[model samples]
Target: MKTIGRIKTNILSMGCFAVLLSFSSGCGKDDAEDTVENCFGGNWAERYAAELEVYANAVSVYNETPTPANCASYKTAAKNYLDALRSIVDCVPTISRAEINASINEAKAEVDREGCD
Candidate 1:
């Protein structure tokens, strides 16, 4: 009977420890900031900057080539740029949507000026 009581106590202790461990480990809260910042996860501004770089590179290529294929690449990159802005607006509602849209408009103007579209 004493051995059985000891086993029950051990089981209860293990269960409590498991619960404590989960709470301390932030279970179910992993990457929670992903939603708060942007849909792609991790530093939103960095991702935005990287996408902008890609668009800039595509724009540069379009400027040199101006072929349909090059223009298509530019358009695709422009779409990605717009998508990132939208995602930022969606994920971080506290941010100014107008500012995000302004950036998008500026990028679109750049694309148009480059004749990429």
Candidate 2:
């Protein structure tokens, strides 16, 4: 049981780490300009940044407490972050789009495995 608990914790940690890594891998200036012109009326970057903050806060809360409610909140924040990232995929280069999609899908799987539902 202890080992299983550790494994779950590690999985969650990895998921959070992946989310953080994806957040860091943002678009370059040219891509950002394209994103601004194409997505959310030039506000996608700001929106994504805001969502990243919210997600970070949620992760901190979940880490501190590990409660079910906090877990649910974390999942919600993760989903929102994924959505924000997804919105600008097309505006980014193809390589970036593939990487972002992979991160999003991996994070989604992690959240699903969290079993908060």
Candidate 3:
């Protein structure tokens, strides 16, 4: 009977420890769920910057080509990449859309001036 009592006490202690462990280890609610906009999960500016970097990379590839073979794929791919980037940037509302717009306009001008393959 005493051994049985000890077993019951051990079981209760284990249950309590499990509950405490879960609570202490952050098992209940996520920080994102607690917040409204989840700016931590990358805000509009962050997303825009990420997409813009891709655009810049595509442009770099398009610009560095000295031959038709190098120029062919990069130029075509740059257009598609730039289009997708612009769409993503446009979807996200910005505090200063003009800044992004100016940069895009500059890129457009460069593209037009180059007239590459």
Candidate 4:
């Protein structure tokens, strides 16, 4: 669950846009002018990965307390994840799902450290 926390912290600090741009700009996947848009999509995916990881953990966490706010955060995180997914899908060019999945898994340990449950 630390991975959830790590990513969440990164998003909260670095913001949703930062994650998207981090990869796009570094990946060298597009023209400089389109970098902004491409980064937007990429970072959104990153945030989605992090956000979902948290929400998924929250599902089990809420099994313990289940407060209204906690439940709502869970939903908001899940929805943000999904919305980010939709954005990736709607991107002009597709991204590598396998790579993204791998990256998310790499952060699993950190997400676990967040103490979700």
Candidate 5:
């Protein structure tokens, strides 16, 4: 269906966006230090990357089967990915919390539309 295709496209786009954002690195030492300090003394990028991987895997599984259980798992993975992004909003000055929140809400809406809730 067209709706399903659109949902897949949107989810893939979000995943790609997150990947690109997570790879954005600070060019200077000061920026790097500030990122780590602001990111709860940890590597938020690394954490986000890990969550992204989990989300990607879930997407793959859901696409292959689309069972209710897999849908729930996919939703959980999505939440985790969004949570990781939310946790690092302050660390990455380039991306705003509003942007991340919008992505989260959009993803949730898409999932709900698919009856994945």
Candidate 6:
């Protein structure tokens, strides 16, 4: 009888430990982006991807039907989008922030040089 009782207690303790472990493992994974270690987390990638799509669409539209005014507008929009990416400089890692800044500067120069040719 004593052996059976000890076995049951041990089983209950193991079950409780398993539940706690499961909960803890899931806790940080769900909020990974919000955690301090991740900083801007996944937002930088998402924002950059979205901005690229917008810039591509603008360029495509301008290319399909070129006009000086439309080209300038498209360039301006793309520049603005690229510039906004710099806002996450402090949030992202150092290497990424430098790369983003360089990209923005390079794109701005390209936009300035592009014309309705």
What residue runs in model 5 are displaced by over 4 Å at the alpha carbon?
1-12, 15-37, 40-42
**Model 6, position 23: C-alpha lDDT score:** 40
Please give the distance, in angstroms, between residue 25's alpha carbon in candidate 3 and its true position after superposition.
28
Q: What TM-score would every model get versus the actual structure? A: 0.50, 0.61, 0.39, 0.40, 0.65, 0.54
| lDDT score for candidate 3 against the true structure | 0.40
| Candidate 3 lDDT trough over 10 residues, lowest sum | 1-10
The C-alpha stretches of model 2 lying farther than 4 A from their native spots are 1-44
Clashing residue pairs in candidate 5, if any? none
Clashes in model 1: which pairs?
none
Residue by residue across 1-117, what tens digits does model 6's lDDT show? 223233223323333333343343322324544543453343444434555567556666776667776676667666656654554445544555566566557656655655555
Arrange candidates, best lDDT first. 5, 2, 1, 6, 4, 3
lDDT of 2 by residue, 2-30 (tens): 23244345434544544454456554444
Q: Candidate 5, residues 1-117: lDDT per residue as tens digits?
A: 235567656656765665565457543334444454556444455657788789888878988888889988877887777677666666555545577668767876776667653
> By TM-score, is 3 or 5 better?
5
lDDT of all predictions: 0.52, 0.62, 0.40, 0.48, 0.66, 0.50
TM-score, candidate 6, is 0.54
Residue 97 alpha-carbon offset, candidate 6, angstroms = 2.7
Model 2 steric clash total: 0
lDDT of 3 by residue, 1-117 (tens): 223233223323333333343233322234564222442233323323444455445545544644555444444444444453344333334543455455445544544344333
Better of 1 and 6 by TM-score: 6
In model 2, pairs of residues that clash are none
- Strongest candidate by lDDT: 5
Clashing pairs in 6: none
- Candidate 4's error at 60, in angstroms? 2.7
